[model samples]
Target chain A: MDKQHYVLQAKGVDISVNSAQGRLPLVHDLHLDLKPGKVLGLVGESGSGKTITCMALLQLLNPKTIQIGGSIQLNGRELNGLKPKEMRNVLGKEIGYIMQNPMNAFTPVYTIGSQFVETIRAHTPLTKKQAIELAVSSMAAMDLQEPEKLMRMYPFQLSGGMLQRVMIAISMCLRPSVLIADEPTTALDVTSQMQVLSELDRLRKECGTSILLISHDLGVISALADDVAVMQKGRIVEKAEAFQLFDQPQHPYTKKLLQARPMLPMEYEREKLVI
Target chain B: MNLLEVVGVTHTYGSFRSFRRKEKAATALSDISLSIGEGMCLGLLGTSGAGKSTLGKVILGVEKPTKGTVLFQGQDLYTMGAAARKHFRRDLQVVFQDSFSSVNPRMTAEKIISEPLENYERLSPSELKRNVAQLLEVVGLHADDMTKYPMQFSGGQLQRINIARAIALKPKMIVLDEPVSSLDMVTQTHILTLLNELKAEYGLSYLFITHDIRAAYSVSDALAVMDKGRVVEMVQDKDEIFSSQQPVVKKLVSSILPEHPRNRTLLNGDVFV
Candidate 1:
């Protein structure tokens, strides 16, 4: 396929940090392709450079202490070395990000309404009244209850699950083309996880928003990812279609990762039968 | 004999005097009742804000309930005398979700594990060292790790240290609050397996509290599904939960994504736009 086929593509990407000891290479030779409206899953153990890879794409990495190399093309536009002022226009307006901890994502002192409205106004030329309307409607779209009441509450007043949904509402309000969710559901409960995953699924289907989903849970990846990339020690050990990676893993690290998941008894029995 | 019994426990947060005019006191746990027999595991499954942790605190005697009784071996936990309360404290231990915050940063693995032992028992410096090393070995950590600090260990390894500390007093029952929830796929399995082995080897009863159904089912013999500060359903047999028709039970169970994409029944949409 041509380079224009994918909405977001990374080639020969390298990420490293400068420390007192020396330069340390954190991620190496990373390549990823996200076709329009498709979900690409990044699965790896903790400290495997998954978050760094996503941050580098958004130009969120600190240039003073960290150096990111290679080409990151978003909608045929180079994004790796974009200036901070230019990058600000691209982030949130072009690509949405859902962080792992929703608590830390928002300012604790600010009400959700002020923050949400401020975000909407920052991205678009909407007036404050229009931004508030957009925020309420977007929150309602995510099935949040009492949007008006939630608007007045501070980040500390909301539960983790509620806060996460609010974060998603804010991210998706502007209808970004690509969403980068880094362990979005890791802090949520099971029921809330289901809601968040379904919302992500809906965005891709209804709005044609591509997603880069990063998680350590294989179950979460299996539910949504069309393609899966297994990372180990800052390298892409294996990349395949979701079913192929889960069913017939080729790489030893991928195999070990798949086997390490705690399976329910019914799933275990099904595996026994398949074998 | 029942190792622990939570009889008609009802706990409410915020006193009536503290509440503003429009706001009412929130009921954390309402008329919750259950019991864990000797050497049995009871998994409390619920969503966030579902009062699972409140119930854990009530059982551990950290919080006095509004209108219920928590009996530890037939003795009222809150109303126990000082001597009995000391016994209760030594017998019941807890491991919280965030291992790093739960432990003191400056304390070495040895000092952290031996904290409980030092409080309850009298041991010389050399004997205490040996005991801490033995405890570390039982939890599958190296004896050399005793000198390491909390930051030097991974999340899973730190959780193991927490577990070693909990079992240091040879407590009869341990309240594990989301012990494996913060770990990755591989490390979660390792910790759950370690918990199961320790339970079998020590004949310990666990009030395992978690929102993850898979982790709960792997360790518990019985399961209780809680929703909105109430036990919506309780299953005596863990496998029987699969056939439960309760809405809360079904919601928690179905939230677990299938092992593979082919088996996924929850999500229904085309792969691409």
Candidate 2:
């Protein structure tokens, strides 16, 4: 594949945290590439630096306590060494982020409309009225009920599922080429999880947005990811096409992970029974 | 006689915003009824806000239902005397989801596990230490781990410690509320295996509450589906979950991500292979 086809590319990425004792490397020589309109599933156990890697891409990590080294290219533009003001332009307009907890993603005190309007005005040349119009349209597109009413509600008033949809809507409103979703559906119930997953699927299909999806659940990754990268202790143990990774995983860890997931009765093991 | 029985149980959360305005009561559980035979694992499956946790709480005596009775060995749990309630507590224990918060951070594994024993029995310190060490061994933790605090252990190990504590009292029934949800897949399997072994060795029953279908099917002898605080369907055989026709249950079953890549049906009707 040509290099220009990849929307986001990271090569030799290393992240380390500094403490009183010394510096401890959290992620080592990680490499990832997200193709345009493709979903890259990053799977790992907790504390395996999956979240940290995504944070590194967004330049969200604290510079004083942590060190990030590597080259990250978004649409052929080098992301490293960009000033805060310049980085702001690339953040929401070119690359969007959806955090795991929707509660923390928005200010509890402000109505959803204000935050959406502010975010739009910051990234685009639209006025507040035009930005609110865009926000309403996007919310309606996500199939959220009463888009205008929802905008007036505080974050606390909405259920978890509703809040997550609103978060996704806000992120997609900017129509970024690349979107990084960190455990987006982990907190949701099965029904709500399906809704969010379908919404994400629609986003990819409709907008052709490339996604870097970070989740521990193999089932979720199987449902959405086009490619898979298994991370263990700050390293990618395996990277392959999604089907290939699940069907014929080369790495022992990947195989172990695949086998570890619980399946339906058709896949049940008699030896697993107690009696 | 059934090991445990819940009949016509209803739980409601009264809104306490202010005395000035009356808020409508939110029904957490509505006329729910179920039974678990002795030494049987009954899986309570539901989505969020489906009252799985509330039902578990009612069974564990953490909350009193607005209506109906929970019976243990044919005796009403709510009407029991103080001494009987104490004995009931000894026979029925619970393990919650978050291990870090469930187990005290400052206490060593020994103290945490030996708490129930200390509360009920008059064992000497050495005997208590011996029991703690034995419990640690049962959960596949090293004997030396008795001195270690919660922070010193991983999420999986801490969960093991919590399991050790739940089994400390030699309970006849244990309520496992999403016990392995916070752990990794590998660790989840290990914990499930350990739970099965402990159940067989101790002849214990379990009220396994979880949203994950795979986890529910792994150890449950029977499964119950709950929606909006009601048990909509009960399957005596675990394999029958696939044939369930209830819309809610069907939605949950279909929501399970395919374990094998070949089983996946893409959006375009093409097989993943």
- Which candidate's lDDT is highest? 1
Please write out the lDDT profile of model 1 over residues B70-101, one tens digit for every residue: 99999999999999999999999999999999
Error of 1 at B248 (Å): 0.9
Instruction: Give candidate 1's whole-model lDDT.
Output: 0.93
Compute DockQ for each candidate against the true complex. 0.76, 0.57
* Reference-based lDDT, each prediction: 0.93, 0.90
What candidate 1 gets wrong by more than 4 Å, as runs, is B18-23
Looking at candidate 1, what is the lDDT of residue A87?
95
lDDT of 1 at B47: 93
- CA error at residue A206 for candidate 1, angstroms: 0.8
Return the top candidate by DockQ.
Answer: 1
Candidate 2 docking classification: medium
